[model samples]
Target: MKQPGIFISFEGIDGAGKSSHIEALAAAFRGQGRVVTLTREPGGTPLAEKLRTLVLNDAMDPLTEALLVFAARRDHLQQVIEPALARGEVVVCDRFTDATFAYQGGGRGFDLAVLSNLELWVQAVPTLEGDFVRNPDLTLWFDLAPAVAAERLASARVPDRFESQPAEFFRRVADGYAQRAAHAPSRFARIDAALERDAVWQQISQVLVQRGWLGAAA
Candidate 1:
């Protein structure tokens, strides 16, 4: 059997500070002399990035937005993530399918049954090889309150379309992550976003050590 390395995804609603954390974790792995490929979903590859801009920029029907996400995801898997993992590098993605499930399905009120069906279609897409069907080894969900997160966004200079979603939508997105964390406690790490940045990093580092990622690299 061909062995592939770990795939870790950082997941959270807008303003949860996941992007910074992903970069930090990737840097940590690189410091350990491990080959790490840092990437983000719905916008990693060239074409997917274009799709991402459209998905984030233009307002469209809810279902259309969901489809665009999966499309970009497929392209990203084929052009970036799968190839890196096949070469035995650690792939740290900023977000993955869970984001779609949470944002599109949970926040936007898309039915889970529909999302499941779409996921099935994505699995069959020829662009993604069957051997690369593996999901993330771990998902770090940065839990944040809608109000607190909103305040953080307000402090920022600019807000994206998703970031500008209604407060209630973000509430559901947070709940979506929590529900997922509860369902897959082993694979998901729930971090409190209200904590200080360094404190949150400490928690993340602890998780990496506990998972044996640090020890194995050492």
Candidate 2:
């Protein structure tokens, strides 16, 4: 069988703790001898990284933000993600298109229709399966209440543009994630981040095992 490798994306609001598990998951896959490309969106490439910096720091309207993000995504896909997948490497990314929908579309109250059009354009790529828009095979969304997330991020570090937003903004972002998950029930695995650390890891690992990405022993 022809294998195009696996793509997995981790998503959540800033304080949801999804970033903490990405390296561990990459290590788990690496232990199984899979080549894992652990990276992040609005990054993963030099040009995209520059774009990420602007997106995270500079003040801009929602439309500009959305455009910049999609532009970064296009570069990321072309330079990093697609090539890695074609080489049969597991591409574990910290964020992807879903983040745009959540942060810009939801948090900024941008028109979803415009974002949708941008998604359609930026995500379209030629794959082993033929021409289609590329998306994560699995998206692990760390679901946390806005209040809980706010409390967690309270003193972590100086806030970025997105991180500095009020809790109400995060609530909308969470709702956006819910909407996305509902639309693609098969692709999303909602991780309850309120659980203890061990429990949260267990949930993530079990889901990977269930999906045959990791061995039962992992």
Candidate 3:
């Protein structure tokens, strides 16, 4: 049987404005009486948070970066996400495995095949029938042009390692997200991040309403 919880993940290159929308969506879910577990990847648990620090700041090769990311994800899943889902909560996570594919496999040019294996291994969820790979029931991909995203980030806070990368890197990352969405079109809803904030939010709300996750009146 499927788990009781609804898993929702927000994805995008930084400066795509996923943060505020994530909170807004969580609030929307709460308004509908769902218990929302708002969390993030690479840092949900104590061990994962420590790994997040290392991965974001320390200079590391593609292999090391991918390893640390998956390691943190494994811990986050075991400690936070899995439990929340099992308890029938709505887990609205800031990012998920798709970020790894977009950043490591695309931005850093890591091996996609290797990343695929890690995704399979780390995301497996056991059931009576067999183990199934866990993924978000819905993934909101805030699609934006790399240049536009960069412009938005210019006046933002200090950059992280990934955020400090060149425009070409973000281009590759955007392509990566496109590839992922194409591969799983049924699960992903692309939001045009270039739109005004209110328009973007309308798209988000429309998606949720269409999916029957929220009431039309909500």
| lDDT of candidate model 2 versus the reference | 0.92
Candidate 1 total steric clashes: 0
Q: Candidate 1: misplaced stretches above 4 Å?
A: 1-3, 124-133, 216-218
| Position 46, candidate 2: lDDT | 93
Candidate 3 residue-wise lDDT, 1-218, digit = tens: 44379999999998999998888888988998888999998789999999999999999899999999999999999999999999889999999999999999899899999999999999999999999999999999999999999999999999999899999999999999999999999999999999999999999999999988898865
Instruction: Evaluate model 1: give its lDDT.
Output: 0.84
lDDT of 2 by residue, 129-212 (tens): 776888999999999999999989998999998899998899999999999999999999999999998899999999999998
TM-score of each: 0.91, 0.97, 0.97
User: Candidate 2 regions off by >4 Å?
Assistant: 1-3, 127-130
Name the runs in model 3 displaced over 4 angstroms: 1-3
TM-score of 2: 0.97
Best by lDDT: 3
Give the winner by TM-score. Answer: 3
Model 1: per-residue Cα lDDT over 1-218, one tens digit each: 54457899999988888877888898888887678998887899899999999998898988999999989988888788778877889999998888888899889988878887777767443444443344688999998888988998998857778888889999999887777778779889988888999999988988999987875342
After TM-score superposition, the amount by which residue 58's alpha carbon in candidate 3 deviates from its true location, in angstroms, is: 0.3
- Ranking of all predicted structures according to lDDT, beginning with the best and ending with the worst: 3, 2, 1
Q: Candidate 1, which ten residues in sequence have the lowest lDDT sum?
A: 124-133
Range of the 10 consecutive residues with the lowest summed lDDT in candidate 2:
125-134
- Which candidate model has the greater lDDT, 2 or 3? 3
